[model samples]
Target: MTEDGGRRGRHETEEERADRMWGELIQEVRVAQTGVQILFGFLLTVVFQPKYDRLSHSDQVIYIVTVVLGACATGALVGPVSLHRLVSGFRVKPRAVRLASRMTFVGLLLLLATMTSALLLILRVATHAGFVPYLVAAVVAWYLLCWYALPLWARRRHPVRPGDRAPDLPPGGPGPGRRQGRT
Candidate 1:
């Protein structure tokens, strides 16, 4: 323990860091899971609407693809919970967390596709306007920017390196905690 009552900042045990990271990942996954489940539920009922029959064949195909994507998103977003349940107390959380995070990422991507397709189908049916494809493309671009680009940028900006390359530790100065023998 240091004077600040903090564990040495640069030296977190693997399990300790994993524990903290897992908490953050779980919170993120919970938000995504809730969204996908709700969207899937709403989608499941849309096909039964009387208006559904009025849709063109192409729009109906889009609807089916969108619904499938939503179902897949729900499965993937909820995968972490099932993974945890199945692997509880197995001492494999770091690997499990990595896999779960990948599942969540896939789920989010699927959710993005589902949303774009659903929006395209709905907009085409509601207005039959000429600009529907352009509109959908714009929305998808926005989602990519918001969900992927920004986070990727942030991650690139602030990377974690070992003590030598790490931000807080200055480069090549006899490493950390060298005492100068001055007169």
Candidate 2:
């Protein structure tokens, strides 16, 4: 909430702000958690597949690294839930939120690594052509652009100033034709 009735418009105390931030953070975590969990699940099954025995030594190592990254990502993404549960009644939600945010960031990075490793292994198995490495590099560049570059550019270019109020949306939704009442 901000001073001007915009986006998350409303005046809120420090505690209220923390609460709202926590809710938003949790929503974001839920999305990342689902993705990492599913990826980790698939990685786990790979080791038991008959095709696992046929991978080259290098490919096998890549698979192992990917599995480890997936595990780390899963742990980090789920860490915030454990952290919140442990700290719930301590009157330190603001601090907890900060720590959880770090954990989420680490989780996202690990997910990126896991994805890159998985892609490398898949491409290696799918083709032995000389262009495979170049292809993987291109895809990694795209991931970097999409996952890290754009958000950072926006953050740097359009930062919220200390006293500036963000534009607010209507209560029902951001625009007209949104459901105005209970449906």
Candidate 3:
């Protein structure tokens, strides 16, 4: 039971919750990091390619922008690891977790932009067709749907209610959102 009289949600302390969430966040970041690193590596090599010299000025600009976006995305994705390394043993895991989460979110947004720009540049160079923009738009829309919409929909559809215990937790454990009752 909480001071506010609401039922506790989990049995873990703040630090414990932070530890669990930090581990999960790192795992998620690892997946994103690998992808962004690969993309950024490929982007970096594009300027050295023989065909790069034949690209139109506009295409060159687009390629440059895509590379910059990729670099930014990579930095943002890797920021959490640095944050943890610097802040470890500071007794601020909870705050660090929150900050890391925000960094990861920003990284994901940057990654989306990076991918979209890269796709547009690729298709433009490959086809030079009038429909390239449309095709890129469609792909960006698909990414938004898959990456953002579905998760948001599920989160909205099934929210955690006050007093509702997490499934994995044993019953009657004192935790956040749990009501305290007379013994």
Candidate 4:
């Protein structure tokens, strides 16, 4: 507890915090990895489709770019697992976790670009309408709002103060009305 009798931050050592964070990061990565891998696999088969040969040269270029971006996203999202395997038992969990988090963020950005380009190519081929660009832009804006804006807003609004307990945890102790039993 602090001098004012409020609960302190999570009672975890740096290593313990790193372990917890690594677990959480891996779970998040798993979700992204599945998505990117599926998208990448689909992109690979597109080139063999009968309709693919009929597409204009510019559309074909867009498809190629989208496929490349999807492959890059897949690599970045899966990099953390390989990193952990290579660094296991080296006593660098904290650093590994930070690097993994950065890779995941980059993966998300690549995934966004991949999806945006894929949508643009599909809409252009389907309708050949002048409004296709506007439609794609609207969808990208929605993705930004859902994936980035809301999270940043919440982080700024609920900045964690030093010595404050984790929000999900109870205020007093291990159990209701009981102080921590530590000596």
| C-alpha TM-score for every candidate | 0.82, 0.81, 0.85, 0.84
Best-fitting candidate, scored by lDDT: 4
Top-scoring candidate (TM-score)? 3
lDDT of 4 by residue, 76-176 (tens): 99999999999999999978987887899899999999999999999999999999999999999999999887766655566555345433235542332
Q: How many residue-pair clashes does candidate 3 contain?
A: 10
Per-residue lDDT of 1-183 in model 2, one digit per residue for the tens?
344543332456546766877898899999999999999999999999999999999999999999999999999999999999999999998678767877988998999999889988988998867788889899889988987777666555664443433223244332322211111
**Higher-ranked by TM-score: 2 or 3:** 3
- What is the C-alpha local distance difference test score of candidate 4? 0.81
lDDT of each: 0.75, 0.78, 0.80, 0.81
lDDT of 1 by residue, 1-183 (tens): 223544444455445655665787799988888888888899999999999998889999999999999999998988988998999889887678767867888888899998999899889998899999999999999999999778666555665433323222345422322211110
What is the lDDT for 26 in model 1?
Answer: 90
* Candidate 2 wrong stretches, greater than 4 Å: 1-10, 164-183
> Given candidate 4, what's the lDDT at residue 98?
72
Off by more than 4 A, model 4: 1-8, 162-183
Weakest 10 consecutive residues, lDDT, candidate 1?
Answer: 174-183
